[model samples]
Target: MVHLSRMCTLVALLVALAGCASAPEPQGNSEILNLQAEAEYAYQLALLDQAETLYLEILRSIPNYAPAWFRLGNIYSRTGRLDAAILAFERCVELEPENQKALYNMALVRLKQSHQIISLARRQNGVDPQVQRQIDGLYQALLRLQQHTPTDSN
Candidate 1:
């Protein structure tokens, strides 16, 4: 009778262990959404590198995640990675054409790049008139975007 009781107890322990092991792990859309939320929270906390990592992870899981792409671009822009930021913003725009933040960020990064180019050109012997005109155009575009951005109440 003791041996039988021990065998029953072992079976019960095994069943409990199996139940714990089989607890549902997040997958599919839920996992992706959770990652995206975590990334946004990290960004809000100004943990930009952590946010970038999470955003990239989300992108890997769901390539068309427009908000993550936009936030990643913002983080890159803050870190002065203008080229990378521009590429990310472009991806965001491609994924969601109506993403105003992505459009603004793309214009801002392009303006910054154009300014750098113009400065370099000025330091050199000769500056191209066409290049200067293009820089002026980007500046105008950036100004327009800045004017249109909604002011944050906080």
Candidate 2:
């Protein structure tokens, strides 16, 4: 019984240490900071391709970097890659649930997606009842989001 107790304590300590060991370091590395600056500069300059590449690189080094994910989502949205934009925004929101920017951007991307779907259906000469139902559902969801979102007083 004594040996068993000792083994359990050792395992518990090791597990705790492992959890601490896996904790991420603060994003204070010079290289990461440099990349962040470059990425922001590129984005501001409207060099979306370069911005996307830099943001992706930052994400690879720091998967929990919510800002990088948010920028990536914006880049994807501007390039008309709505699905990818939604996915990137979703990741950002996952990392920072209180991120109003991510949530708002995601809603915008969803609206764009609905527009594309409707346009495509129109170009095909008819909207399937099922597809129309889905589009209506999307509109309803957007309306709900809008109602709940606080308008800027500024």
Candidate 3:
């Protein structure tokens, strides 16, 4: 009887351990959606810094969150972090190839960076070759985007 009881107890313990060992599927999309909503509300309230932080947190949670990436790019651009903004925009484009907003923002960010580079070149005695090359490339890319982007002035 004692042996049978020990066997039953071992079976119960194994079942409990198996249950505990199972991993839960992540609800990444839903959590990111909630974070995005909160970020939007913060932006609407003029809490720019808070919105930026929340957006960054969302990216940290879901690296491939395309909308969060696009928004972060916008926030970074507004805060004058042009390089980071460009990178975030690139990530958004990579994740969502059909995202026109990301593509447009990327073009805009590149244009801003190019202008900054030109200003720096004028201020310095000698322009850095690498910087000049980057600026030229960015300018060309921006022009191409502008040419391709549709106008809706009417």
Candidate 4:
């Protein structure tokens, strides 16, 4: 049953990402920027595997490149690799704690996976409740992040 459900999810995910557009580019070091163009192009062209590989290679050399991590997360999300997406987004947030987009994406991925986690947990052979609670925390954080900041009233 789980396998069938996963395959159906995979098909739906693929259709949704068939023409998915690339996310915003992050400004990185000049050396990193030099390598980013090809990866970005691959992403824009929806060559997800190629884009992922390129992004991972960049991270290997510059693990602190938050943009690469964010982009990799986006790619993973589009391709239905939710766990990988969460990891990439988490890395992006860790490197750039104030990046709203990374925060949002991390929350989004966690939200999507939370449904699965909760449902599976309720099915008698479920996962630990702590996982569900952690996702709830992330969701709350995302909501706090999306709150509007007061602008100058002058």
Please name the candidate that would achieve the greatest TM-score relative to the true structure. Answer: 2
Off by over 4 Å in 4: 1-34, 121-154
What TM-score, computed on C-alpha atoms, does each candidate reach?
A: 0.63, 0.65, 0.59, 0.57
Q: In candidate 2, residue 30 scores what lDDT? A: 48
Clashes of 2: 0
Q: Model 2, range 32-75, lDDT digits (tens) per residue?
A: 66787899899999899999999899778777777778889988
| Clash pairs for candidate 2 | none
Ranking by TM-score: 2, 1, 3, 4
- Candidate 1, residue 35: lDDT: 75
Better of 2 and 3 by TM-score: 2
Kindly give the stretch of ten consecutive residues in candidate 3 with the minimal lDDT sum.
Answer: 12-21
Judging by TM-score, tell me the better candidate of 1 and 2: 2
Displacement of the residue 65 alpha carbon in candidate 2, Å: 0.4
lDDT scores for all predictions? 0.70, 0.73, 0.68, 0.67
Writing each residue's lDDT as its tens digit, candidate 3 over 51-119 gives 989988976865666666777788888788989988888997787676666777777777667667665
Native-referenced Cα lDDT, model 1: 0.70
For model 4, state the Cα shift of residue 115 in Å: 1.7
Q: Write the per-residue lDDT of candidate 1 for residues 1-154, one digit (tens) a residue.
A: 4335334644553453345555764345456656767987898998999999998997786676666677888888889899998898899778767666577668777766766775565555447787677666766665676577653211
